[model samples]
Target: MAMAQNFRSAFHGFNREDVVRYLEYLNSKHNSAINQLKSENQTLTDELKALRAQTVSNPAAEAECARLQEENQKLLQQCGDLAGQIAKLQAQMEEAQKNKPLAEEELEAYRRAEQAERAAKERARQIYCQATGALAEATTQVDEAAEDFKLLSQRIATQMTDLQSTIDRSKEALTGAAATLYGVCSADTDSQ
Candidate 1:
């Protein structure tokens, strides 16, 4: 029998209802086939028993009896083959049933892993945003500090220019006082 391979997907895994329904369908078909084979085997066995009884009571129909026996043997062989097939099918079904839970567990593990990965990505994105904001704030503060330093340098340059002009005026005044004192001393000496 051909097995189904495709199943509908659900959020967590394959759709449970669809998988269960398919399994139930295959089981029903298998049971029916097994029952039919058993029924045919029983019918053949009954007929063979009846033929054997007839052969014992009536020895004149030996050729017909031999032919019937051959046909019965062939039928029995066919029934045995059918029984072997049924056994194999049952074994396969049992194996499938045994593995169902393991498959579900694996699918659950995959779902959990996917969720964790998404959470990690979200955390990384949040960190990136925070770092970018901090960088922008630091850049603004540095620009402000640089502007303040430039203004302070300009003010110090102006103060130095004013101090130099005061010093030049003081030097001229002292020179004029010295020249007047020398001229007064010379006049006094000549008059005496």
Candidate 2:
């Protein structure tokens, strides 16, 4: 909207005083806006710097990752021990089957051996199940860590983009204000 002017003033389509006053007001407003923009830019820049610094020190995530790795190693070792036990039991059973004994005492011993083999197999199966659960838990922790890192990176990226956009807008606003003030000052000087 244009500023209202009393055109009935002496020899004028619009009041020169009103035009000057409006221009002064505009120049002051632009100056104030420029100062505010500079302040906001500084604040945003500081916040971004702080965020970057925080990204550098994610010690908790690192520690968690290390702990998960250790757990995985332990689970793998347990799985290996269980596999060895299973193999040994299978070998013993096969040997017993090859040496067939007909005596009652010998048959009773064979039955006991079979029972022991079954117990060993069941224990191995239980250990295998435990190892599987541990592995899955480790995998889940790793995935959560990855997701957290990704979210932090995305947050940083978004902040950087916003800061850059504010800077660009401030620059454009300053440029436009400078051009407008220059035009007004030049016109005043020329009219003199």
Candidate 3:
């Protein structure tokens, strides 16, 4: 461009009428450069607007929201089911605990009854043994009494035989005394 200015100066010294022609060529070149820059800026602006509109119209964002809502519903239902199961199990455990003491009491009652029955049976056995011992002692005393009676009967028969012999000897002595008295009486009568 400096060389073009020098050429314009030299041509101007030749004829002052060429000054308009040089100014016209420089203006045309500047105009062409400005038009190219304006067209490029307009094309970049249109691309940015198209990208903004496409982002607003997308279906992927809507599908992701629906999926999240469905997952939340499933989680809530699962939690409710678990809570119900826990409540039923707790009730069953409490019922079993309530019956435990009653069963233990019944078992203790049966044990006490058996112990009382055993004590009663032992008392009966002791009484029976005592009665049997008393009966045996009485039977032995009766047998001893029978043996003493037989010994007393034999001693009485021996005393009766000795008394009969003494009576016979006394009768002979009395007959002799009576004969002597009769002789004395006959002699006295003849003398008189």
Candidate 4:
């Protein structure tokens, strides 16, 4: 029964974000525990190596062995720290993945903002072109052209106000998305 249960869990790959977070917590705890065990293992191995080196029959061999032992101990200590670092990196990686939803949401929101900006720009272009064309058709010396120019100028002014409003709305949405993105990123960073 226990074996079947273990096998089931092994293939139970559909964990939710919140569940994954809990799994991350458990994994971090396990890594810390294993790291402690590795430290003890390294100590014992270093002691064994030192004992082996000391049993050599030559004085020069003993000196060389002592030097080598010191170097090995330093290397082992470095490895222990690196193991802890590996755990830290693993935790960070899991965290980044967990925050992917917020990042994806920001990406989507930015995409919408980009599309809105493009539409606004297109509208502005069309308005400017219409006004310019009308003004161009009207000659400065012709009364109709002069009158059309003034009207076009007025329309342009109005369109400018519309463009400003569109820009303001876009900025507001971008700002909100930026805030949410910043919150998610900062939360992960603080936890790490």
TM-score of each: 0.64, 0.31, 0.37, 0.34
Candidate with top lDDT is 1
Q: Candidate 4's C-alpha lDDT?
A: 0.71
Return the lDDT, model 1, position 178.
74
lDDT ranking, best first = 1, 4, 2, 3
Query: Which residue runs of candidate 4 sit more than 4 Å off their true CA positions?
Result: 1-57, 116-192
> Which candidate leads in TM-score?
1
lDDT of 2 by residue, 58-152 (tens): 76755654555565556555555655655564565454445434334565887899999999999999999999999999999999999999999
Instruction: Give the residue spans of candidate 3 off by over 4 A.
Output: 1-78, 142-192
Models sorted by TM-score, best on top: 1, 3, 4, 2
Q: Is candidate 1 or candidate 2 better by lDDT?
A: 1
Model 2 vs. true fold: TM: 0.31
**lDDT at residue 126 of model 2 (Cα atoms):** 100
Off by over 4 Å in 1: 1-31, 55-64, 167-192
Residue-by-residue lDDT tens digits, candidate 3, 1-192? 652554444311422223334344444544454454345444544544454556575566446544544554554455455445545545554554575566567668877988989988998888888878877887777777777777766666566666555665555555565566666777888889
Count clashing residue pairs per candidate: 0, 0, 0, 1
Q: Give the lDDT of residue 51 in candidate 1.
A: 72
Clashing pairs for model 4 are 138-145
Worst lDDT 10-window in candidate 4: 2-11
- Cα deviation at 162, candidate 3, in Å, is 12
Encode model 1's per-residue lDDT on 67-145: one tens digit a residue.
6667667766776776676677567667667878887888899989999999999999999999999999999999999
lDDT agreement with native, every candidate: 0.73, 0.66, 0.56, 0.71
